[model samples]
Structures are given as C-alpha cells and as structure tokens.
Target chain A: MTLTPTPDAAASVLAWHDVSVSIGRTAILDRLTLAVPAGGLLTLVGPSGCGKTTLLSIAAGLLKPGAGRVETRARRIALMFQDSRLLPWRRARDNAAFGLRCQGMPRRQRLDAAQRLLESLGLAPEDGDKFPHQLSGGMRQRVALARALAIEPDLLLLDEPFNALDSVLRRDLQDLVRQTVTARGVAAVFVTHDLTEAIRVCDRLVVMAGPPGRVAFSTGFAQPADARDDAAVLAGLQALWREPAVAEALGATPGRRRVTA
Target chain B: MTMATTAWIGRVTAAFLWRGWAVLVSLCLLAALWQVGHEVYGGLVLPSPMDTLRALGALVAEGVALPAALETARDALMGFGLAAVAGVLIGAAAGLSVTVGRLLEPLVRFFLGVPAIAWVVLALIWFAGSGLAAVFTVVVTTLPVVIIGAMQGARTLDGEVLDMARAFRAPLGVRIVDIYVPHILSYVFPALATAMGLSWKLAVMAEVLGGTAGIGEGLSLARVNIDTADAMAWILLALIMLLSLEGLVMDPLRRRLEPWRATRGQAARERRS
Candidate 1:
C-alpha cells in the first residue's frame, strides 16, 4: 500500500489512496482514489453493481481493501445503512445513544445527548421512550439518524439511508441529513443510486462504474445544497446526464429520453 | 416515589391480582372435577379434594411434609442450576462454530432420546441409594433441553444487527452483554421453563425409585401402606410447589429480563384500556 501524498491531505477528512478490493476472482473496487474535504457532503452515484456500499464499508473501516490504504484524520466515524438497524430490545433513546454507549460515555450524559439529537431531528421527546417496533418507519429512521449524529463523529458514511421511505419522507430526511452534516461541520460520504437524490443534497458528486469500480466523472455544485430546489436539482440532473462519461457510466441512453427528478 | 411510579406499581399489582384470580378459578374447577371423580369412584379409588387437603394438613402437622419438600427442592434446584449454567456455556460455544455444533448435535440428541426413567434406573445402579441419584437423573434428563434452547438462540442471532454493532465499534464485552446474551435468552427462556418443570418431575421419580427421603419416597411409603389419601396429598404438594415456582419465580424472572418482549402488544392494549 502506497500513500500518494496530496497538497490538501491536511484539509481532507478522509482519503482513499488507490484503494482496490477483490472477493475471490471478482474485483469489487479497482484502484479507486477519492477524498472527502472537511465538512463536505460527497455523494457517490452509480448503477447497482458498481460497489457503492463496498466503498462506504471501506470508508467506515469495516472492510480492508485488498491493496492500498484508507487514511482518515477523523477520530470517530459513523455509518448509517439503508435499514435503521436499531436494536429492537432498546428504546429509541437507548438506540440513539448506542454509539456513545460503545464509546463508554456515562449513561446519563449519552442518553441526554441522544434525547437532544432525536428532538433536533424532529422526533418528539416522548418518542424516545418508545421501542423501534412502536415507532413509524419515518420516525425509526429519524432515530437512526440521531444515533449516527449522537456520536459527534468527524466523518459520516451513509448507504442509501432514506431509500426505504416514501419520496416525501425521503426528501425530508435528505434535507435533515444535509442540514445536520453542514451544521456539525462533519465530512460525509453518501452512497445512493438515485442521481436526483444525489444532486439534491451533495456539495460534490462522483459517478462510479464497473465490477472493478472506478470514478467516471466528478463535479462540484457551486450552489449550496440548501439553495437547491426541485427545479435546480432537475436542471443539475439533466446537465449531469448530458455528460458522456456519466451517462455511459450510469448505463443510461444519452439524448434518447428526458431525465426526470 | 413519584405519583407516576406509584400509579405504575398500582397498575402492575392490579394485573398480577387479576391473573392470580384466574388461576384460582381454574384450581377450583380442578377441585370440583376431583370431587365428582371421588363421588363416582368411591374412597379406595379417588379421594375428595377436601380429604386430600386434610391428609396434606395431617402430614404437615406430623412434620413429615416440609422436610421432604425441602429435600426434593434442594436436589432438583441443584441439578437445574448446574444444567442451566453448563448448557448455556457449552451450547453457546457450539452455536458459535459450525464444527463444534455438528460434533455436539448427535450427542445431545442421543442424550435427549434416552427416557428419564432409563436415566433413573441407571442412576439407581450407579448411585446405589445416595441422594446424588436423584440429582443425576434430573440433570441428565433436563440438560438436553436447555442446551438446544441456547444453541438455537445463538445460531439464529440477526447478522444485520451484529454488523451494525461491528460498524459502531462496540467492544467485545458490550457485544456479548447487549447483543448475544439478550438475543440468546429469548430462545433459551422457553427451554429453561420446560427444563425447570421436567427437573421437578424427574427428581421426584428418581427419589421414588432410589428410595431417597423426599416427596417421591413419601409417595412410595403411602403406596406400600395402601393409604390413597396420603399418596394423593404428596402428589398435590408436588403440583402446588411446581406451580408456585413457575408463577412466582420463573415467569416473573422471564418478564423482568425480557421486558421488551413482554410489553410488545400489551403496551398498546394497556394504552387503549
């Protein structure tokens, strides 16, 4: 493993230096180099087989690349999956406090922090006392987001966390996540298949492709995520679809059909 | 205590009492059935519930009941405690590894297939009139049940939740306590309750055959004397003890340990009510 030093290595919260992974004969991620700038929301958009979730797992240090190194300045990293994955036996507050509990924070302090985070994420205070089964899908996801945020992580890895929700709920959670990440100044790498969703929330977007996944195209949105309305996102999506490399990487037929948000 | 806590305690007490009342009603129904049987079959064949109670009272007055009950309780509980601890440790080890599980499965099945009576007979030969015979029979008969429960619990643990725990970097100790133990207990508790009931039955049976001084021995003596009421009294005593242990101890302990499961639908119903 070699670390190709970058000028902004100090500014970036996390950097993957020529990271490659293989499972048996199949190459999952091939020499994929990427970085998330401090406090930036970077979205990875791609087709199904492109190893987007694999990238997040590597980012979270849950999986090691077959070659190369993942370097992160962040002391604490939190990953949120598509499913809530909250412990059913624990109440919402306790679930939210899980990361803190793992870190050996005192019970009272962690619970209080979790309670505050849950409330900030639009969950009612009383909702924290309810178990995962008792909460609505949207509410459970909110608790999950609280769990991710409660650890005060420097880097956040999200794997299509809002995918299972309805479109409206998805949009709301997207806004909540973007706001939280920006407000906390935590760098985040979000993996999503939905190009429009990516355009809706990200500061910088990278399009990935192939069984041996590699970045095909990447761009930065000058307009802030908070400023991007549906029209702005749709326009951005159309513009991205027009990029030959992105359109090909995403396996979409270019100029044949209009893109819809 | 706060008013809310006091109110919560009151509600719980009320629920407990309501359940106790239902149990009492069932017991009364059983007693009525016994009275009908006694009237039809006469004194030699079946004793009335009242007569059986009187005989039980007489046994207590003669100081024969309490000591025998205590002796049987000690032997049964000792075996159960050993089996529970060993089963959980061994079963968890087996469940965690495919090779270990495969190796132990048939051995456990063989042990389970052997009838409790057979174990009792073996224990009689091996222990030769020692109280260890009863304890040995109880453990051999009940260990398989607890082991299977724990194995199933460990084997069926949710992989996704475990992944979540790993991603969060939960420590090994935390993972065991928060994830493994609670998850396993859900599967193991029912098995334990079953084993607990079996332990008492096997203990008494072993005591009867092995000639140990316990409720089983008391029943044997009554049988030899041909006093049907005395035998019925001993049987009644054993049933009451088992029921009380289940109602007052095991069930309550399960509810306490698994409050999340205990309150699942009941919480909603309680809110509605």
Candidate 2:
C-alpha cells in the first residue's frame, strides 16, 4: 500500500517506496512506505524498538534497505542525532561548520557562515570559541542544528535530537527547529517517542509499531504548529490516544476502557 | 596589553618561577644526600656532588662532554623518530581492522616480551661495532610502546561520532584527518613520551655495550679506569639532557596539540562560575 502524505509527487522532497530492513534473523522494517513533501515537518512517533530510528537512518542514506527503494529530490541531506555528537576537540563554530568543511569549503567562509547560524540560534559570538564540553546542553544542540543547516540541506533528518534536554529546553529547541524548517523551506523527518511533542511540532504525524515495524496510523494536523497552545497540544494528545491503533503503537492503554463487571 | 592578557602572563611567570624554585630545593636535597654518601663511602666508590660537578666542568672545558652528549642525542632521537612514525602507522592500520589487530597483537606482545638487553645483544651482533647497533636497540625497545598507544587510540574512537561523520557524508580523507588522527594522537602521545624516555636509556645501554663514542662510552671508560667522579658526571649530563628535552620540548608540544585537554579544568571552572 502506498502512503503518500502529500498528493503531489513532484512537490515531495523525499519518498520511501516499500522500504524494508532486517538485521540477521529479525525484521526491523516491513515494506514501509512514507513520504515528506517539500517544506513539511513530519514526525514519526513510536514505541522503543519500533524502527523509527532505522527509518530515519534510511532517510539519511546511512543504511541500505533490505528490500525496496528510497528516492529523494533533495540536493543535500543532513541528519541530527539524539546526542549533540559534536567533536569535543572542536570549538562550537568549527563543529557547526563541520559539514561545510567536509564539502571542501574554505575555513574562513565556513566559519563566517557558522558564526551567522550560531547567532541566529541564540549564541553569543564568544560561544563559538568554546569547545563542545564547555557549552550547555541546549547550546550544544543549537550547534548541532547549525551544523545540519551549514550545508544548506534541502532535507533534514532528526533522531530525537532534544531527548536529553529538560522539558523547557526541549520545547525551546522544538520551536527553534520548527521555526528554522519553516524559514528555510526544508523538508524534515523528526523521529521521537514523545506524543505531546510530536503533536506540537508536526504538520503530519506517523505512528509506527512492531518488530517488523510498519506505520500503524498517520494523520495531518489542521492547526499550524506555531499556533498550537498547551491546551491545544493536550487536546490533540487526548484525541490521539482515543485511536486504538495509535494507542497500541505507542504502548499506551486505550483512552476508553470498556469496564464490564 | 589587555587586563586579561596581563593576568595570564603574570600567572604563567609565577608558575614557572614556582616550579624552578621547587626543582632547586629538590636538587639541593639530592646534593646533600650525595655528600653524606661520599663521606661514608669515600672517593673510591661514590664521588661527592661537588666533585662530580667539578669533573663535569673539566670534561666541558676539555670539549669532550658536548660532542659525546650530542652523539647520544642524535642516535636516540633518530631511533625515536623512526619508531614513532612506523609504530603509529602500523598500529592504526591494525586497529582499524579486527583481523589485522588480532594478527599483530601476538607479534607486539612477543616483541615486548623480548627484553631491551636482549635487543641490544642482538643489535650488537647484527650491526657489529657501528652506531647502528645503539639505534637499532632503541627502536626495537621503543616501537612496542608507541604501537600499543596508537592501537588503543584508534580502537576506542567514538562510534557515534563516526556515524555522525557518515551522516554528513564526510570523505575518507576528512574522516582520517579530522576524526581518526586527532583521536589516535591522544593515545599515541603518552606512548610516545614513554617510548622517548625508554629510547634514551636503551641507546645508552647499547652504546656502553658496543663501545660507541657517546656518554655511555665515556661511562664505560670511567668504569674501566675506576674514576667514580667521571662516571657520576656522565650520568648527571644524561639526566640533565633528558630533563631539558622533556621540559622545553615535549610538554609544550603536547599542550599545543591538545589545547582542549590542557584547558579542561579551566573549562569546568568557567562553567561552574
């Protein structure tokens, strides 16, 4: 079955067609089909070991699918991991400029570009000189985000990048990611287990489940991400839990339990 | 200068002076102990520190000390440089592949098991009376240490970081230079330092046995002539050379290469503040 999130094929930046992955004797992903339209924020929410990360890795072209194809119209694809994964020896600016450096950009130009990105992400100029260990958790994530953006990627893949941060910091980074994606017109596939967070940031949501992981449920939110207040997010979460497939995929108890004594 | 730069300069000066003072006090205590030993054993066995210094001065005045010291330094440094380059390259290759690592692990252990004295004896036989004997012994003894360090560094490189690099589509050259080299150097440096000290000792030992024209040769001559003061002087010269090299060269190079590690405590303090 084809699961095209957006109708226009030409307008999509990434399309995973019948993607399947297996490790040794165990199946991880089973003929999963998903798509992300240009300038869209899509969240893949699922329980642990549900192949959400596997799907993202496949999207990033880090891993090959066992059977099926991943097609992307993106000129450059960048991935951000759960941990900041910044080089400890490199200063924040150097870490942010790492992708550009990999592309053979001259040091001065890449550093200037990184400096501008850092500033936009709410870092002081001096913060660029600080090593990864010296930066706070949020600041390090900002550097990682800047690194992803440094290559001017058309498609961005995030694997729970704010998982380690506190709630407030996580929310701030979520907003930052959302704003950056919208501003840059980049297609992003965000993988997380947090439903409330998934509801708050995504234009479209995908819930996956099973050892042979496949999409259990998917929906598009009518409300704009920026306009979704706390109450709206809570309401969305409550409504999502009401769906038996979503509740099962997330390993949460169904909202209405039929109590027959 | 800015206030911060001034403060930094003041701190560095103070640290240097303080370290120099401490070294002076320790040397004085050593000298005092040597004097006591001289008084007990007399001039035939152990010379007084002053007598040794006087003998060293005489050797310097006669233009014998500097050339012999330089000869020894050249041999030791040559072996150390060769071993450092070869060990790091071979070890990094082995570390990157499990099959190669397993194959080389037993070989490294075997080399390590063979004593430095054994290598000196073997080198003496192979190279005859040439200075190559001393150089060969130093390389054989020191190579194992550097190899182990480089191998460990390469083996322990962070997998997540490698994944991140791949996600960025880093080329092979970039991965090796920016990722592998720095991580490997962290492990290789301490090993290099250890190997350097070992190289000097092994070179001198080989020289003494092979009768090369170096500090070790001078010591051998002193032993044959029963000149305890001369022997003590040569030993003192060797110690001074080693200490100077370590202080003036190695430490500064290490700090320059790994500024992040050198300033870790300061970074922590800043974060706390």
Candidate 3:
C-alpha cells in the first residue's frame, strides 16, 4: 500500500470524464471532459472566475466533482497552489521535502533528495535552511515548486502558478517549471489566465468556457513556424477570441495583447 | 576626553533623574494621603505609607521574611506550572477533536463560571488545612483560563495550511510540530503568563484561609495580632515580588515567541490560496 510511483508508466496519466462540479447550491462545472497525456503539459485557460480553478481543484483531488468521474494512474497527486503555501515555520528545504517525509522516508535521505531537486531547480544549497517569511515572493514560490517537484508525482496540478510575479520573474519561473517537469517526464496540468504563457509551456491547450465550465476550445501546439510571435498565431488567436460562443461565454474580447500564454 | 565623558554621564543621569522624579512625585502624593488617613484614625486603624515601608525594611533585615517570601514564590510557581501543563494538553485535545471538545468544554465552562471563593472553601475542606489546599485552589483558579486560551489557539489554525500538510502527506508528528505547535505557542504563552499571575493571587488567598507557612500565613498572623501596619507591609511586598517574578520568567519567553505572531497574523488575514 505504498504511495510511491511505479516507474516508466505514463499513458493516460489523468482523465476527467463528463465531470461536473458544484459549490453549495450553485453549479460551477457542467459535464466537462479532459485528459492529460503522460509527460505532457496540459494547460487550462479561460477568463476570470470561469471554473478553471474548480477544475484544477478537482483534478488535484482537493475538491470532489459533484458528478462524473476522475481517474488517474497514480493515487499520489500534488498541487502547487497559486500563492506559495509554504509553512512559515518550516525552512525552505524542510518544506520542499515535506511530501517525501510524509512518505516515511528516512531523515537524511529525504533531505538529500529534497536538496538535489531544489539545487536542480536553481535554489542555492543554503536556501533550504531559510524559513518562508525570510524568503521573498519569488523565492517562496520556488520553494513551493520545489516541494511539489520533490514528491516526483505522476500527476502535478498547478493553479495559476505564476500569477503574482512580475513579468521577468514569471518568464523565468515558467522556463524553470518547463525544464524541471520535462526532465522528469511528469504529467502536469497547468492552469493559467494567459494565452501566450500557456502556448509557451504547455504542449496542448484546453480552454474552459463560462460559469458551469465546458470545453469551449481545444488545440494542440502543431504550429510549423515559430507561432509565439508570428502574425499568423496572433491572427488565429484573434479569430479564436472572436468566436461568437467564446465571446458570449467570456464577456471580454480576446484582444491581441502579449500575455503569458 | 574628561569633558565629553562627563557630559555624556551628566545626560544619562539627568534622564534617569527625570524618570525617578516622576515616580517619587507619585509616591509622595500617595504618602501624603496615607499620612492624612493615619492622622484621622491614628496608628492602629490605618498606618502611614512611611510606617509600612519602615516595617517592611525592618522585617527583611530580620532575615526570616526573605525565606517566607521565597517559600510562597516556590509554591506559586509549582502550582502555576501544573495548571499550565494540564490546561494546554486538555485544551489542545478538546480543540482538535469536535467530539472531545464538545464533551469536555461544558465541564470547563462550569468550573470557570463557579466563583473563586467557592473553590477555595471546597479545596480547604478537601485537603484539610494543608499546603495542598492552597495549591489546589491556585490550580482551580488558573486552569480554566489557560484551557480556554489553548482551545482558542487550536481553533484558529488555518484549514488551508492543514490541507497543504495533507497534500504533502505530512505525518502526524510533523503536522503537530511544524504546523500546530507554532500556531498554538503564541496563544498559549500569553495565557500562561496571565495564569501565573492568577495562580499567585489565588495561592495567597487560599493561604490566608487555610493558614499554612507562607506570606498569606504571615498576613493572617498579622491580622490575628491586630498589627495593621505589618499586614499592609506584607501585602505590598507580595505585590512587588509577584510583578518581579512575572518580568523575570514570562517576559523573555514572550520575546522568543514574537516572530510567530507575524506568521499567524498573516494567516488570519489570508482568505484563500
């Protein structure tokens, strides 16, 4: 009954099948279906308050879907919250190693694993000894990311992981996340409000529509040319934004502003 | 070199003198009123502040007074320590589990609501004029406050933090130490300080009633001998010692706990992740 992952098993890591979620008397997600490919970065993007967070919560198993089913390859799933939820009392390294420690790993070994993962993620060797309050906003998020990464989860869910950072730091963290998860070949579902940021990091994009979230748009990163800054990508983005159903569901126009896709 | 050092010394002395003068002025006003009362009622009924101070100094120089005060202090410290440990453990258990909390909370409320004097009488009868009676009363007076305080600390723990702990698959020990302990320590220590004060007050009161060897015994002896000045003198010495001990023990502990307040404060303000 151990929670450790059996290695090299990635196919259909997590799936949400006809899942609908409700909070209190109100329905938030309406019959939505999504799947994460093994070692794939699946980004969920939508306008504000459009059940993106709810879907992420359900996927992380923090919130149970009101109806339908959620299946996953591994029972152990870790979610990195939007705000770095590092325990202020614990040092950066202890917080990082928290999940492994929970798995009943021995102290020195847990510390070693946590240290290695954190160092790989650009954390200084000494940084793990500092408490969360002593760390800045960026550093705390990095610690949180390290904690999630240390668990070596088969499935990782992130809720707007870079929402609070300045643009440069956000880009750096985005790159860091991509590099770390890709190296480990872990399945990740990253939720973001930005289109370009999603495009930059995620292999595929799944966009949720409205309050009772439905899959309004789904696309893969199959652009032959460099679509990040290309005129065609911008035009296609605009066209997607102008889709009558998308515009109606989300009140904001899909304006062509450079954002973390 | 001499001039500058002299100037610095003079400034420091002047600041000290100003603070001393303020305290001296208040003391003089109190003394003058006390003198007026002694003038009206005469020596036996109401003693002047100067007479009480002189009596206190004489009692201390006699050497027996210090040992008596120390014994009383030792008893108070022991009683407070017992109350604190019992209260926090019970409170944390009650606060963490709803079934335990609901079952035990009403009993605590009943004990807290019962008047202090009632417990003193009951403890005196139960322990039969022994030092245990006084200590028992002190515990009764202080335990409920500390228990309620620890319970409040436990209830205020952030649910989101617990969820984070769960997601990380933290063991029970880790959850309690890194998560629960830091959150509860701030609330527990301040309540402990207050309880220490309460225990001391109850200890003295119980001694006066139960009549054992302590400051309270001395106070009762003063009353029996009809020496009003000596009684007031013992009361004043007891107050000074209680204040001193609180500053000595609890103040440093509170200073160590200061950093935790900031984190708990932030947790209170945060509504969601």
DockQ result, candidate 1: 0.54
Q: Which prediction has the highest DockQ against the true structure?
A: 2
As for TM-score, the candidate ahead, 2 or 3, is: 2
After superposing candidate 3 on the true structure, give the runs of residues whose Cα lies further than 4 Å from its correct spot: A1-10, A48-50, A112-127, A166-168, A223-236, A242-245, A253-261, B1-63, B99-118, B121-128, B222-259, B263-273
lDDT per residue for candidate 1 within A1-261, as digits (tens), equals 111122333588888999989999999999988878888798999988788999888888788899999988999999999999998889999999999999999999999999998999999889999888778789999998889888888899999999889999999999998898778888899999999899888888888988689988888876778888988887888788767888889887744556632
Across residues A1-261, which tens digit of lDDT does each residue of candidate 3 receive? 011112223468888899988887777888987777877687888888789888877776677888899888866688898899887767788888888888888889988888887787788888877777767788889889988978778888898988999999997898887776677777788999886577667666677777778887676645421224445456446654545564555465457423223
- TM-score for all models, in order of appearance: 0.93, 0.93, 0.75
Can you give the lDDT of residue B161 in candidate 3? 85
Q: Per-prediction fnat values?
A: 0.61, 0.63, 0.41
* Model 1 spans > 4 angstroms off: A1-10, A254-261, B1-3, B262-264, B267-273
Better of 1 and 2 by DockQ: 2
RMSD of each: 3.9, 3.3, 8.2
lDDT-best of 2 and 3: 2
lDDT of 2 by residue, B51-148 (tens): 99999999999999999999999989999999999999999988889999999999999999998999988998999966699899988888988999
Ranked candidates (lDDT, high to low): 2, 1, 3
Q: Report the error of model 1 at residue B183, Å.
A: 1.8
- lDDT agreement of model 2 with the native: 0.89
DockQ (Cα-based) per candidate? 0.54, 0.62, 0.28
- Model 2 spans with C-alpha error above 4 angstroms: A1-10, A254-261, B39-45, B262-264
